[model samples]
Target: MLPLFHNLLLQLDSASGILRITLNRPSKLNALNAATIEEIRQAMQYALDAQAVRGILLTGSGDKAFVAGADIAELAELNEIVGRRMAEKGQEVFCLIEESSKPVIAAVNGFALGGGCELAMACHLRVASENARFGQPEANLGLIPGYGGTQRLAQLIGKGKALELLMTTDQVKADEALRLGLVNHVVPAAELLPFCEQLLGKILSKAPLAIGMIIDCVNAAYDQERHGYQTEANLFGRCCGSADFREGTQAFLEKRPAAFTGE
Candidate 1:
């Protein structure tokens, strides 16, 4: 069952274990206001706690934008202290999405700028529509990416390219984003969510625990202090002790499909 969220729509496909979240403020081009961000955080937490949720497909309502950017009016009211707090809050929320146990895929159907771009970067995978546009246009507003965009964009693409995009406020098309490794797939606008669901469905069929461990290890690779190899080794050892590992190996020998309980 889908729970009601003030600024978002949540729908869970129990059979597929895929949760679809739509950013609902289409009139504003689905801009990320504080309320919307908080609602998203709560919704993500709800997804995490729901046992039936195996994967998430995040997108926005309407055809125009995934999220154009942050709500400019709200942004205009920030003082230095308030601005710092807002940035920290946004970082924390996006961090949760990045660190989610279940894979979260961004189905970027249209304009994804500033926070919108950062939001997509936070997802484990991103699928964009052929007409999708991505940019960190905060430079034009006399600001910069405040929600982990500076770091995540560079991580997804390259530091040099990320800097150029940030400074120039240049928008990249879906094809260029794919070429730069910013998005995984580029599909027709109508197929965006379906493509993400199809890809996530395949991933959700695997051992859920192992999938979570993979996310953790991959994230560790980006942390300068944490040795990714060590994290992988540790997670590997843990997996060795899981029932899913035993079942997986046994099923391979038996030539049957393995059933993982996420234990």
Candidate 2:
């Protein structure tokens, strides 16, 4: 059963081990306010704790926007201290999503600007609708992306392309985003969720423990302090000692499907 969270900023539903979380502030273009940010953090924690939730699909409520940006009204009220706190809060929440044990896929339906774009980047994978748009428009506001966008954006695309987008505040169409390696796939708006589900379903069929390990290892690649190869080797050694590994190898030799218990 899916836990019933107060639906102030999000609509949460679950089925077949897949949790679908829709950012629910269409009237506000799904902008991230303080309350909404807290709700998202709580929702991600819920997904992480729930054994039934093997994967997550994140999207927005309306066709107009996946998320337009952070709430400008809220931003207008921020003093230097408050502004720094707000950025830290957002970064913490997004980091939780990025470091999740289960795979989280962002299905961008429309505009994903500023914090919206950062949110999508935090996900394990991203799928965009044909009409979706992506950008970091904080430069126009005399601000910079504070939710790890400066880092993740450069990592996904190259440093030069990321710098151009960051400096110019250029909005890229879904096709261009795909070309830049921002999105994994671009489909019609109507098919975005279904496409993500189909892809997640395939991943969910694999050994869950290995899936988690893969997430950990891949994330380590982007950590400047950690050597990616060393991380991978450590994880590989750990996997070799797991029951799932034994079962997988045995099943391979037996020419049969392996039943992974996630052990």
Task: Report every candidate's CA lDDT.
Answer: 0.94, 0.91
Give the least accurate 10-residue stretch of model 1, judged by summed lDDT: 1-10
Candidate 1 displacement at residue 19 in angstroms: 0.7
Quote the RMSD, in angstroms, for model 2: 1.6
TM-score of each: 0.98, 0.96
Angstrom error at residue 34, model 2 = 0.9
Q: What is the per-residue lDDT of model 2 for residues 14-77, given as tens digits with 9 covering 90 to 100?
A: 4558888888888888888998888888899988987778888899988989999999988989
Compared to the true structure, candidate 2 yields what TM-score? 0.96
Q: After superposition, which runs of candidate 1 have C-alpha atoms over 4 Å from their true positions? A: none
Question: Model 1 — TM-score against the truth?
Answer: 0.98
